[model samples]
Target: MLLLNNHTMKSKIEKSTFIVKLTAVLVVLMISIISCNKELTDRKDFSNNTGGNVIDAQQQKVLYVIVDGARGESVFKSSTPNLSKMIKNGMFTINAVSDENGLSATSWADMLTGVDKTKHKVISEDFSNNKLTDYPMFFKRVKDNTSLRTAAFSISPALSTKLVTHADVNTSLPNDEAVKTATLAELANNNAAVVLAEFQGVDKAGAQYGYDASVPQYAAAITNIDTYIGELNTAIKARPNFSKENWLIVIASNKGGDYPVIPALMDQTLYSKPLLNGFVILYNPNFKSTIYNKPANLNSLPYLGSYGKLNGDTIASVDAAKSNLYNFGTTGEYTVEFKLKVQSFGTLNAPIFFKTSSPANAATGWWIIHNGSNGTWRLGGLASAAISTPTTKAMEVNQWYNIGFKIYFVGTVRYVQLYQDGDPIGSPTVITGRTVNNSEPLVAGYRSGFGNSATQFITDIRIFNAAVPDAVIKDFACQVLLDSRHPNYNNLIGYWPALDGAGTLIKDQSKSKNDFVFQKSTQWLSFEDYDNKFCIKPTPELYKIVPRGIDIPRFILGWLNINATGFNLDGKVWTPIYTNILK
Candidate 1:
């Protein structure tokens, strides 16, 4: 009986061991199946299917609209239903600012060329020199792509000559009615890669009649423009080709005009009111969050990032750095902050200061900041160190820092704070009894003195109309330290007026001097018959005939040489170079 019981126990133990081994095998098989399924799903989503039709590159198109003089503030007040709807549905830049030059021709030229006026050498309406004419105009660079059609219509006479002379297609009609017709016709063609439209009657009227008299005309023009813009939007929506993956439309204003003057003048000189110039708005439907993930090796040095529009031909690093300097307005409180990554601490004790360009008094509208004599940050309105802290902590190299200020009621201010890696430095110090003056341009990246420079990586820099809440400020600092995205960062780079097929930077070569040359060429000469004697002259006027034997640059020639490799517009990359530049 004892032997029988031992055998039964042994058999049960073996069965239990077998059951445990089987369970382990099943678990491993389930995990393997899940892992394979995940890999397959990812491949299916991104991989190009062999049976699907490949999209031809020539079918891509972009619409770019530049309103000659529209203020960021006035966009909401202007009763532009179409623009407002687009802004809400797509993307809108609330604090979009333009560069220094307020002139339409200069600003538009910068927009089209992406090169500074100094490079393009086209500054104002009176500019007649064709020295830079041969440089490939923006459209000329992409015109050869057979699938890519290009056209531009401008209501401003200031732009008419330049457009006809430089653009790939001169489609400007005499009046607003003609502009609508041409714009619609281009839309119907379905082959165009880019279409640029400019409206300037309001600007002309504003310049002629005073701001008040021109208000109605401006309002009327905006209404008409809104109607047409809506029509275009509707037409594009109706087309099968108009998908998020295929088409993009950009709407923006070249600059803002100044009217209803406000006492507060912060960087108003760039586009002062009664003429407020530098307001620009952008809308892109295809934008994704990844666009702001600062591209690898994107130089963070001042002026190395996207250079804003500024005066002068060649904008040096200093000029680029100086572009962000702004002043406090007369009435409201203003705040400015810089997100910088420092490398090493130098002998410079006072790394930051604020002061006016001139002595702070009742009248001047400019102010500046710099290092103070007492080893502290100084406020422009106050004589002594407004915020004092020991400079004992060694500055960490390649780490982000935040320099912020809160200015109350013109010059009556609170305190400024400096944070290194999200922690406030030492203590919060205060300043008392100072008048707000706007005599000097506000500056950063150096001491209060002229040209006290520093090499730092700056990003997500911002200026606010109201004092930033401490909680929001802390979150901002934390995000910067963690390398997280902020609303303002999106406002800075992602909300561009236009974008390429990849939904990255604006694809229009016009924004950069990609295909155009700014040098003199016979092809750019304007001809006139003086008493039946035809004479060619270098002028801003348009030429009807293409000049023969014009010397094309090596880069352009290289593009032309490769035009036969199924790479030219006809094969895939629809562009206008053959018709506009090569001709």
Candidate 2:
């Protein structure tokens, strides 16, 4: 009976082992099938949109216009009839803000490459490095993919020289008259995919003369560009191909100049304003919606856990582990909640603050909210409170605190409400007496009251179009932080860079410039001998005299020792011209 029982156990164990092996094989097969399916799906999606091995349909006719040194306010004020019509029909970002540096090469390069200057490495005018050729430009990438024709006409020498190099046909014209002629010719050809025209006479005039003198020229240039744009539109409307083919017209600026130096005109703070510097217009006949939100928009209240150390120079250290949601809808309400997992509590305790680009125009206007970590919240204009304290009792490190706030726009006025955890901290803070409306970008983070490093780990950031109720906020907080059962609980978007292969620098072996340089073989040939054989040339007389119709130089013959027992000057061992030899 014992022997029979032992045999039965052994048989069950064998069956279990077989089942495990089968399961492993099935899992591998499933994974392989899923991967193949994903590839097929991607291919199908691309084919449906791009016409399956055909070129991009929308790139058939594209017009790009750059208005050099036109301020955002000036763009709005000026009577650009054609541009106005485009704006009315197309989409525009009223509160668009650029980098703080305002360098022309940097911004223009950003627009063309779709990458910021931080990545492109094109910072200033004096940057003359050949590194710009390392990354493919927009035109270069598009040109490689399609057979579309391209052209550019520009007034600014810098724009004409640097930006136009990637295009197929480019003309560096000085004025609008020349630009109009070139543009008309390119449009008439019916083969142009992109026609870019840049007008810079206004900026040039401003630099030479005063701002007042340049204003008229700027206006005249605008009028001319508008008239020509209208003419082009009319021409396109007349063409039968316009209905069938897709086209996009983009108008923008490189940078805006100051009026104080050029002319003692109205002291319009172009530098202080955000959107005043530049704007982008997208005109597509097939455009379904005028406004298309960028994939990763700026969060209404972006949180920076540790924004630089107390004495450090770093402005803010963003937590790449947190979800940053950018709201694209116009002038709505938003709320952000974050838990501060304090490691150590010390003096200099203050509530987390909120800031926006409203008061100081798009360039400035950093409004703030006070002591958001605690129950009491304060909302004030830029730089109103001290973040440091002598006592360490207020903030105890290693303690967790909940902070949240609400921001809503009432017509042109924006209101703020502060909350600590689930409780309302104080009265609704109203920022009033504004010359302008709420058309600025919003940012949020911890403030030391002064400039101090915010050393706190924040989690559970949520944004809403309308005001979120206390119950919903509590549920979201519990779902994300307490219970950890939120659908997107891991903040997956924040960690996407690691998954999608973006955070790491991928080495491209196909790029010849990036290929490894192997050391020259020292055994085969010395550097001096290689140079002499390749760099030195034989005389015509020496070239004509050889056994196998090959040249045998006297110097080389002496060096080679033709008289030696092993040496011969026949077909087997004839002196060959190094220049004629290909490596």
Candidate 3:
């Protein structure tokens, strides 16, 4: 669905460009409005400007809870009524991320230190050689700036011992129940301005069983934490100064466990890693519901299809009748293109794609082949002919490359052009007198004697009757799948994606209906096209809106109306709700 046709895609880009320009102007106006009203009263009015509740910074308290290994998808699937209520009353997102490293030590530091693993150096469980002193926990920031009472409760002793520095009351308990009991006790008796707690039951359950909601133990553990959350919320509400206090309840996961997500939930990027998947909720009575959902990207269709890894043992071919139009005779003009990733340099003159009875230079045929001399490809035909030429540049192994060639006639003069990634490889070589037409079927992957030692991957075969222009080839070189954007769309006589996933017949998408049939067992391969160089930008809808653990400290600072710029924190405020509150 993300692969819109050329016209639709162009229209979308134009509209998106205008909206971005408009958003830029609006952002300037919003900044001006914020700067003009720097007072707390004016900021409070600004919070309610969009009809949200009036929130006083002085009365704000935070109860930030971190649950380990709670996959956001699993949490969404589980029955957590308490969390659902908070989601309705908060700025929340199921598509939030943790530190990419996905280690407890790393994400814990990310949540507490307001920085990534690269800055904090807490990449392992032992907390060895960390830079915690330079970027100490947020509790230290609060202690240095204000006299506010801060408390930290955790089931992991290392968190209380290693990371929870400068908290007025820091305690490590044995289990989730003990942690919850101590947190409930603190809320009932003490008036802590910030209370941070960590629970480990979900992570423990995930480690024992699995991280999916289908696992009874994992689902039960999540519901159990929800129960504890319910109890904690009850205690907070029962406080004597409840009506006067404005509380910000923050619930989040340090990281997700190692489990494959369902296809429906897969983002098909680095963000789709199970360990990087987590959730964040910044709940307050005054805030309006704002949820950041997963955005659709250009990878929505995901170039997921069958690829061929020819290791000298497999060959695919089209019948001569079906492949006759593909042969560039003395008079005809044609183009051939395909994607290739060389696993290793093959035998001297390995036939990658050819249309002939023999692959010898003296044979009356043409081939797109690997030249063992310089680890590059060359055009092969009758010996000492213009149709035989080697590419100037060598191709690297294990990297995807778009390889193409076109033969056309300008007046009575004929020329053969080579292309690598859609750019002409040197200048065109004249082959006016060379005749490469053959009666043999068009063959790929293997031919007698020339392909036995070859190893490479091949897919997305395209054959056009018209000699395509250089501009059009370069424009669609990185395209994973062809569409109407191609100027020679109607001229394609053969188009085999070679991605049937499980079949001997490589389906043809072109109007000519010429399909390539495998002569032997095809070595089908699977890969993700997430790293396509063509459409590299992520979809704009939720680009930077998804929250992260590093943002927790900045969120706290913003809620408390504290200036975070002086702290040199490496995080942004979690939501736009706190934008006007930041000094």
Best by lDDT: 3
lDDT of 3 by residue, 1-583 (tens): 5556877999999999999999999999998886666433332422112213336423668899999999988899998999999887777877777766678988899999898778889988989999999999988877776788899999888888999999889999889999999899889875668999999999999999999899999999999999999898998999988877778889999999999767875553656777777888888765667788765662553455568677666888889977778667778788889988777776576778888787767777887777763568777772254244445567777777888788888999988888888788867888887777778888877787665457777788998889898899888787767778678999988888777777787888999777788886777888765445443323322335677778888878766656677777877655444333322
lDDT of 2 by residue, 372-413 (tens): 343223444422332222122234454444555666666777
Worst 10 residues of 3 by lDDT: 43-52
Of 2 and 3, the candidate ahead on lDDT is 3
Candidate 2 error regions (>4 Å): 1-59, 205-220, 259-271, 274-276, 288-583
Candidate 1: C-alpha lDDT: 0.43
Model 3 misplaced regions, further than 4 Å: 1-54, 262-267, 298-543, 576-583
Best of the two (1, 3) by TM-score:
3
Angstrom error of the Cα, residue 285, model 1: value is: 3.7
Model 1, residue 37: distance off in Å is 19
Tell me which residue pairs clash in candidate 3. 306-499
How much does candidate 1 score in TM-score? 0.41
- Residue 10 lDDT (model 1): 92
